[model samples]
Target: MFKKIVMFLYVMNLAFVGNAFAAGQDREDGLPGMPYRTPTDKEFRVCADPENLPYSNQKGEGFENKIAEVLAKDLGKELTYEFWLDRQGYLRNTINAQRCDVIIGMGSDVDTLRTSKPYYRSGYVFVYRKSSNYNIKDWNSEDLRKGIIGIVGESPPTIPLRDNDLMANARPYRLQRDLNLPPGHMIDDLVAGKIDVAIIWGPLGGYYAKKAKEPLVVVPLPEFKSERNSFDTLKGKAEFNISLAVRKKDKDRMEMIQGALDRNQSKILKILDDYGIPHVPVVLSDKIGN
Candidate 1:
């Protein structure tokens, strides 16, 4: 009888071991059978520009660069950067090609690109001289009848700009010193009085408005929607969210990347705020693109 009892116990132990192994296998082979493992001892890749300021650079001084650092720390991995000029083709050639795993500081609304939830949002604003009596209450206020507004060629402005019939009057001009230009430079011309007003991205608008040493007010554009910003991966890449991209495929490394982002979202935001990263949206509106 004692031997029989011992045999029963041994059988139970074997059963438990089999179940454990099955569960582990299931986790490793998630539904659709893609292996999802938490990565460790890996370097996660981020795409960045070598010279772009306020965004990213090799020195890792840009806002996105700092955010990457925080994310890497949270993931328990090292941060690796791939330098690409901030151009239309950068994402495809670098990020999509697996040269980098993520594109930080991307517009969250770009439907063609996949994005994580927005950590910050801001509206397009026109920066103008403080001395000007531009009572531009929002994007589509009637007060704009008094002045000419500058905008970048083929850039997105809030609804009022799109509907207000000002595109005909607002002239497109080149403002950035670099070939990879940002729309905010129109505001630079506005401060210099090259143009009366400039529709600009919130961060750059906020940054240069202060730097010009000119009196400027960042008036919120009504009907002007806040552009949600986030990091990007390839569209429909289901595992892209949690996986780390290496030049070669390594399942364990991917797990580490996912763990890092999950663990560090809050800390990343705080670091961004400390540097005046300018991501948090002060307002929320339900209006869709007009």
Candidate 2:
């Protein structure tokens, strides 16, 4: 009887030891200490617009497409895209729905969306017909005093033009349109001496003016400068910035993304410069608001 009791206690001890060991192993496997675990087959989803240019398109030819490509390469994941027309439905129907993990081409200062620190910078610009005598290199200078300045209706640029006393005396009119002409016909008119100067996004103005065979020059507007362009995620994901969105529970994935972003910052900036991404003015956000 004594021998049997001893044997039973020994077997019980062995079973307890085995169970403890198994539990420890399970804990380690579940939450292993590592930078970031290997991603599953389908990890990052790049959300983009099908028709937006210089930003993204279905054909994967825009700057955002190129950025997504580089990020995917670094993450060792296959890239996928959620293509949707850019509109109010973009965030609710697409990004927030998890159709895609990230949204590129978002404004850094947008209150509704959370964004990363400034990645690139450019500014709204003044484009003029080459023959126009007005040279508006500086928005504060008296140069703008000499001619009519055309601007798109209800744009960020309108704020500055209104606040500055420079255009105070001059009447502001909508960029005129002609019924008999196709779209961008006003640009043609500008080339043929119909309008003197216009304010526009630097990239579009520069590209289109050149495309239109109009000898035009570009000048950055002073007040509306420094709009930082960044990728956006839903609000409150500040710790896991949308610079690279991952599953909220995936801390490893977020760290890997941060690592990739840090490693590729220089290359990213170089690509942006080479392509003239025309980002919003980045450094001057605090002083200027619209």
Candidate 3:
């Protein structure tokens, strides 16, 4: 898939990852849960990617997990999850399958499932080892014209890479690969001096940029400083709104979940800060029909 962000966000329906729930619960049709309803018990059920760090993981170490914690505590509900490996068919298998009632870090724009008001927004970014002293601020910078650029192969970022004529030195990586394998393929290469900068999804880029063996610098593409829609030309490369997702027709639950998000926002923001998530808020274009 050339548009890897599509795979990461929409397809991230989730992977075979996360804490396991007991399989003995009774179901009307031998499924995980019923579709289109909130839990009757005191649980906030989440559909999660088991291995996506800085987001959700089995150990509950990721920021999304922290957000879930804030949510459960605020709503006076216990936290639980329906784990699914992030891959194609994830949506059909988890939330859509009614295995869980919510997806904690989904893009607000995902049309398959109903999404809450955006809790946060972020975009793709350029990450390079600071020791390399790369000073690129935008895709058109002359500083970027001379180095190896990394990206999820064939993604929307490639559109700008081509437009800016930076594809000559570009490197590509897979969007879907072995789950248990080592992570951070692009930033890993950047840190190893294999590439000058890696254009990656903002959250993972910011998290890994800080952890690179050498100090690393992260520059938000199009910079969330400008209009959040700066990359609209490339169709969703630069920024996107993130929120919780519930099955279609789940408006009642959506409002309840959105209320939790709206109330405990500060606590949720603190959790994102603790994980080094690059938080960007979305700005709408009511005039342009966004």
Q: Which one is best on lDDT? A: 3
**lDDT (tens digit, per residue) of candidate 3 on 152-233:** 6544566667666677888877655546555566777787788888888877888877776788888888832213324343
TM-score for each model: 0.63, 0.61, 0.81
Please tell me which model should have the higher TM-score, number 1 or number 2. 1
lDDT of 3: 0.66
What is the per-residue lDDT of model 2 for residues 1-290, given as tens digits with 9 covering 90 to 100?
A: 11001111111221101121121122212232323224356677777767555556789876678888887898888888878655433444454554665554443333233334445555556777767666677557566666666664434455556556545533343332222443344355567766667665554454456567757776665543322323122111101111333323445554565666677877776666655534443454321111
Cα-based lDDT for every prediction: 0.49, 0.49, 0.66
- Which candidate should be chosen as best, given TM-score against the real structure? 3
For 174-232, candidate 1 gives per-residue lDDT tens digits of 32234455434666678768888877555556656765668888764443333331212
Q: Please give the lDDT score at residue 121 for candidate 1.
A: 55
* Model 1 bad stretches (over 4 Å): 1-41, 109-114, 139-142, 174-184, 224-263, 271-290
Which window of ten consecutive residues has the lowest lDDT sum in model 3? 16-25
Those runs of model 3 whose alpha carbons end farther than 4 Å from true positions after fitting are 1-4, 7-39, 223-236, 286-290
